[model samples]
Structure formats: structure tokens, C-alpha cells
Target: MSNHELGTVQVYTGNGKGKTTASLGLALRALGHNFRVCVIQFMKGSSEYGEYKALEKFENATVHLMGRDTFVNKEAPEVEDVELAQEGYEKARESMISGKYDIVILDEVNVALDFHLIEVEQVLELMDIKPKNVELVLTGRNADKEVVKRADLVSEIKEVKHHFQKGIPSRKGVEH
Candidate 1:
């Protein structure tokens, strides 16, 4: 396959702060390769996150969030949450088919599934339907075992150290 035809789906998980960060790194890498990247921020609406703030300015990437753009309650996800998640999924699916983006990162997509905001089956279907040359990446904790099974690469970031434990709050340009 030509370099343009290289396509694979990656899953980044585990209890770590860098799941999304790693995905963003990949997105930047792809963009540097002259590949168009699309990032769908499921369950995230605010653009205050450092990556969002930086990536949103990139010419080759577009970021969109489906939910109300607030922190979620893992203990109490409502049906409306699922609906918004579906909307985000649809946007991802649409981007997958639009054939414009070379790489698509469904950031926090698995979290939506774990939270029952999106169906795992639907994600699988979308993955199956993607173009052969379109690369895909999914980021979030608790990514389904099925998803990990289907992915070409699955990396879990186990947290061994975090400054947050020492009471350093998240900051702009570093941990927004």
C-alpha cells in the first residue's frame, strides 16, 4: 500500500492523564505528514482544554464536541447523554465517510460508551465501514475489550506518577 493508503485504528486507554494527550500527539504527527485530521470530542463541549486550545488553531484539524461540554457524572448518565453521544458518533461517522480527513481521532469516544452514552456495536460498525486508506484513533478509559480486540494497536497508560497528587492544579498550556 502507498503511504496514503496506510490505515489503522488505535485505542489508547488505562487510568492515565495522557490518553487524550497521546492521541493529540498522534494527530499532530499525522498533520505534520500533511494528513488532514478530525477530532471529535465526545462528552466534551468546552474548548478550555489545552490540547483543544492548541489543536483548534491547527489548519489541518477540526474539533467538535457533542454534549453540553461539561464534566460528567460516571455514576449517573442519562439518556440525553446517550443522544448527544450519538450525535457525536454520527459526526465522526460522517467525517469518516466524507473522505476529506486522512486521520480521525474520536477522543473520549470510549468513555461515552463506558458511560452508556454511545453503543459499542455502532462504533464497531463505523470502523468496519471506514475507507481502507483512512486512519482512525479512539481515546478514552475503559475502552471495550471488543474494541481492543478489533484495533490494530492498543496502548494503555498506567499512571505511575502524577503531580496532581502533590496538589498542583491543572493550568493553561500544560494541563488545561
Candidate 2:
């Protein structure tokens, strides 16, 4: 079924492991119904991610990688990092306004904002201009308070326990 009728602002944020996973699950559900989905991943540039590889098979899904593989210096990000984030933000704006997507996911945008790679005002403006028929999903830790206040749904996935504490590295299929 076409999902042109869908619309809502959803946020997945917190210090948990499943924020991106949750959003990807939503994308999978939408794609199953033949909805057009756009994912703009901020602060993540690896093409080796499992979701990236998996989503490549969906004709209705588009994923944009917008950062270097190296971690951005939160206190003083590189010029390239800033540039990529801006590019990603512009792409997200275009996707939302183009009316070509049923769902748009800004993965890790909250962290982009937290790291000062993008301004919170710009994100707020994007929210203001979102078409009534477009569904927006923002995923990352440290979501801005204003964003949370404006969202139609906000899910905070707090980390109760994780294997990372045991010094286990990210697994291939599970984390990447």
C-alpha cells in the first residue's frame, strides 16, 4: 500500500543501543507496505553497516551517509565534518519538501546537534516546514529539549545493561 497519507514527528533518543535499530525497524515496516523511505545518517560514514547493506536491496529505500568514519571531535569538529552535516541537513530538507517520501529518518541528528555540527534552530525550522503528509523520524542520543517538545512521539531508550560494558566489541550483524 502507498503511504502518502502518513505524517508525524517521531524521536528515538537516549544512551541506549537501539535508537537506530528502532528507526530502521520502522523503515522496514514502512517498506513492507511499499512506502517510500529516505534515511539521512548524520555523523556516520561507514558503508559497512549491516543496515546500510540490507537497505540497499529495497527499491523504495534511500540511504545517505554523511560523515567520516573517524569520530568527530565533539569539542572542535573538523571543517569537513561540519560541511558534511550541512549537506546532509540540506538533503533532508529537500527530501521532506519534495513529497517523494512517506518517511524520512534523520539518524544520529541529535548527536550532530549536540556536537554543534548543526544548529538546533535549523532543525526546528525543518520541523516547521515539514509537509503534513511526511513522517519525520529523528534518532540519536541527547535530543534537544525543544525537539522533544515538538515531536508527536518521543521514545527514550535508556541503557539498562549492555554487553559493551564487558569489553565486547561490536559484532558484525548486530553492531557496525
Instruction: Report the number of the highest-lDDT candidate.
Output: 2
Against the unseen true structure, what C-alpha lDDT does each candidate score? 0.87, 0.94
Clashing pairs in 2: none
The best candidate by TM-score is 2
Which residue pairs in candidate 1 have backbone atoms (N, alpha carbon, C) closer than 3 angstroms, thus clashing?
A: 45-69
After the best TM-score superposition of candidate 1, give how far the Cα of residue 78 lies from its true spot, in angstroms: 3.4
How does candidate 2 fare on TM-score? 0.97
Model 2 C-alpha lDDT per residue in residues 42-112, reported as the tens digit of each score:
99899999999999999999999999999999989999999999999999999999978889999999999
**Candidate 1 Cα lDDT to native:** 0.87
- Which runs in model 2 stand beyond 4 Å of their true positions? 4-6
